[model samples]
Target: MPELPEVETIARGLAPVLRGRRVEAVWGSGLPLHLNRPVDLRALRAVAVGRTIRRVHRRGKYLLIEVEEAGAGIVVHLGMTGRLRVQPAEAPRAPHTHVVFTLDGGGELRFADARRFGWVAAGTPLAALAVLAALGPDPLSDLDAPRLRDLLAASRAPVKAFLLDQRRVAGLGNIYVAEALFRARIHPATPARRAASRAPALLDAIRAVLEGGIARRGTTLRDYVDADGNSGDNARALLVYGRQGGPCRRCGALIRRRVDGGRATFFCPKCQRR
Candidate 1:
């Protein structure tokens, strides 16, 4: 799944190309694509065609393209193997191309998902979009030590699981959470409240890793790319997420991996003692 940084990268890359550009047409594959609800081609054309794209931005892991009229917009979630890119209107569609938004001049913004897990939703009063409305505060913008402390203190789940809960702190996924915990020296299995005393450090670590990811564009182990079809550089800079059995950069302790809630978590046992 594309996390905050990846989603933000796509939004930033698309904003200039899409802003002020009118959607001239909307096309779908006719194959089943997750619509979030039952939004069909007619519904998409009604909200999108002829409306100028006001802006492109990200909320949690959702990408939003707001239109100029009635606070209406389109929302996209890149489930696992999804990609969004802009290319010449005449360019050949990629293998799984599911939705194409033809811009007024020459290009098209395309959404392709090999796995069909991603979704698209078009609606009015953007606030009425249930998925986006239910997301918690974006960690980069709204989270701080005190706020993180309160959230953690309320959960008995493992610290890793607590942070992974989108309803508690939006945009964190398994990859970033592992790196953040390693940086904060908090064990993934530590009870959330038990880790609350280190909330300041944990919050700083979370922000540091997330900011670093955005600065590097994002971590692309696979399938993730910015709107320009470029892979992220941050994967090479990862500290712990996929370095199982490798020596820890800080203490030379062997890096380790474990599965928590079916997600791979990497850490240094010596550094991240419970």
Candidate 2:
């Protein structure tokens, strides 16, 4: 799944191309792909067409394009194996391109999902969107140490799970959580309450990892690409997420792997202590 950084990358890349551009036409696959709770693709056509995109924004892992015409916005969630692209209107249409937004000029914004797990929907005012409304504070925003400290002090779940919770720290997923934990030298399995003392370092680590991921265009281990159809470079720069059994980049100790909250977690056992 595309986490905060990948989603942010797509939003940043799409903003200039989409802003002020009118949606000349709307296209759908005629099949549902879980848009806002398994809605039909036809449902999107009515709301998406005839709307002008004003801005692209990211909330948690969801992408929202403000529709200035109708005071509504479109929300996109790139589930596992999903990609979004902005291409010429006459570009060769690729298979699995489930949704296409023909812009007012000469290009189209496309949403492709090989695994059919991604979803899209229209939201009125965006703030009223249920999914976006439910998300907690964006980590890239005003999520500071004091606020994060309180959140950690109240949770008993494993630190990794707590970090993954959208209600706690929006935008963190398995990949960034593992990397952040490794950077903070906090074990993934440490109880959140017990991890409070490390909250400052953990918060800094989270910011560092996310900023690094965005700067590198995100980690493209699989179906992630920006609006320009470019793969991410952050994977090569990853310190821990997928380096199980490899030497830690920081300490030269053998990296370890475990499953936390049903997701693979990597760390240097010598560095990350419970």
Candidate 3:
């Protein structure tokens, strides 16, 4: 999944080109997105085709594009293998290029998802607001240990599971969760309430890893690219996400991996004590 950093990279890269541009023409393959077949594509075309984009905002893993002319917004979710790009109108279209928005200035904005996991919804302002309303807090906020404790004080789920829940803390997926937990030296299976005391270090690790990911563009294991179609470079700087059986960066102990909640959870067994 393209989490906070990856989505943020796309939003930032797209803001300059998308803002103030009017959608001159809209084209899309006749395929159902989000499995919400029978979706009124006409509504999207009618409301968005002529409207000018006023802003590009990000909410968790979603991108919100405000169309001021129509008093509406377009919401985009880059599920798994999705990529949004800005290119010349005459540029060659790649496979699975599902949606193309032709701008009045001869530029083209495209939404291409190799696996059809991504979706774009065009509607009134609520299109963006509904998405923003569903997510929790970002790690970059002033979410200190005590506050974090109040949030997870009731859950007995593993700490990693708590972090993965968007309702608990939005914009985190498997890769960053594993890395953050390892950095905080809290075992993934530790009960959430029991791990509350470590919230200060945990929050600090979350901010550091997420910020570092944004600085590096994002961590690209596969099929992730920014708006300019560039892969992330942060994979090289990862501490433990995919390093099962490898030496820990901080300790000589070998890294380990286990299946937790059907996801691969990696850690330095000796460094991340329960």
Candidate 4:
């Protein structure tokens, strides 16, 4: 799944290519991809056709493409597994391209998802508030240590569960959460409040890990790529994620893997003290 960094990279890439371009047409071939939104395929074309692309932004994993006309924005979510690609005008459309945006400038924006889990919606203000209103603060935004501490302290779930809760903290996935907790030296099985005293450090580590991933354009694990179809560089910089059976950078401990919430979590058991 493309987490915060990957989504941000996609938004940044799309911003340059999509700005100033008029929506010549908007149409899709798949069943309703948007979560709980109306699936009328033709409605996309009716409202979005004359509008100009204004800007592209991201909140959590959702990408918002603002347009001039009201209720005609494009909202994308790369669900458990989804990808967006900017393809050449003549390139053959791949299978699973549920949605395609024909640009006035002679190119196409394609939304292809093998899992059919990705989503697309059209609305002004992008319906961002309604879509992401339940999400917690972005770890890379104004969210700070004290606020994180309060949220964690208020939860009795396992720290990993708390970390994975999108309503408690936005933009963190299994990979980043495992990496951050490992860096903070907290066991994944630790209760949320067990690390209450170390919340500041944990928060800092979370920020550092996420920022590092963003700087590297996100980690490319299972088919995650930027809009330009480039692999992320952060996979090389990861300390714990996907490093199962590998040595830890901090203490030379063997990185261990375990299933948590049905997802793989990698950690340096020796370094991540319980």
Q: Name the top TM-score candidate.
A: 1
Mind giving the per-residue lDDT tens digits that candidate 2 earns over 159-255?
9899988988899988899889988999989999999887789999999999999999999997788888889999998898889888988888989
Q: Pick out the ten consecutive residues of candidate 2 with the lowest summed lDDT.
A: 34-43
lDDT of 2: 0.85
Residue-by-residue lDDT tens digits, candidate 3, 1-274: 5888899999999999899999988888877667655335676787688789899978778887888855477788888888899999889997888888899989999998888878887757644455566777867774667778877687889999999988788888898998899889999999999998888888989988889999999888988989998999889988999999899999889999999878999999998888
TM-score against truth, every candidate: 0.96, 0.95, 0.93, 0.92
- Clashes by residue pair, model 3: none
Go through the candidates in order and give the clash count of each: 0, 0, 0, 1
Residue 128, model 2, lDDT: 82
What candidate 2 gets wrong by more than 4 Å, as runs, is 35-43
The clash tally of candidate 3 reads 0
Could you tell me the lDDT of residue 239 within candidate 2?
91
Error of 4 at 244 (Å): 1.6
Range of the 10 consecutive residues with the lowest summed lDDT in candidate 3: 123-132
Which pairs in model 4 have colliding backbones? 71-124
Give per-residue lDDT, candidate 3, residue 234.
Answer: 88
TM-score of candidate 3 to 2 decimals: 0.93
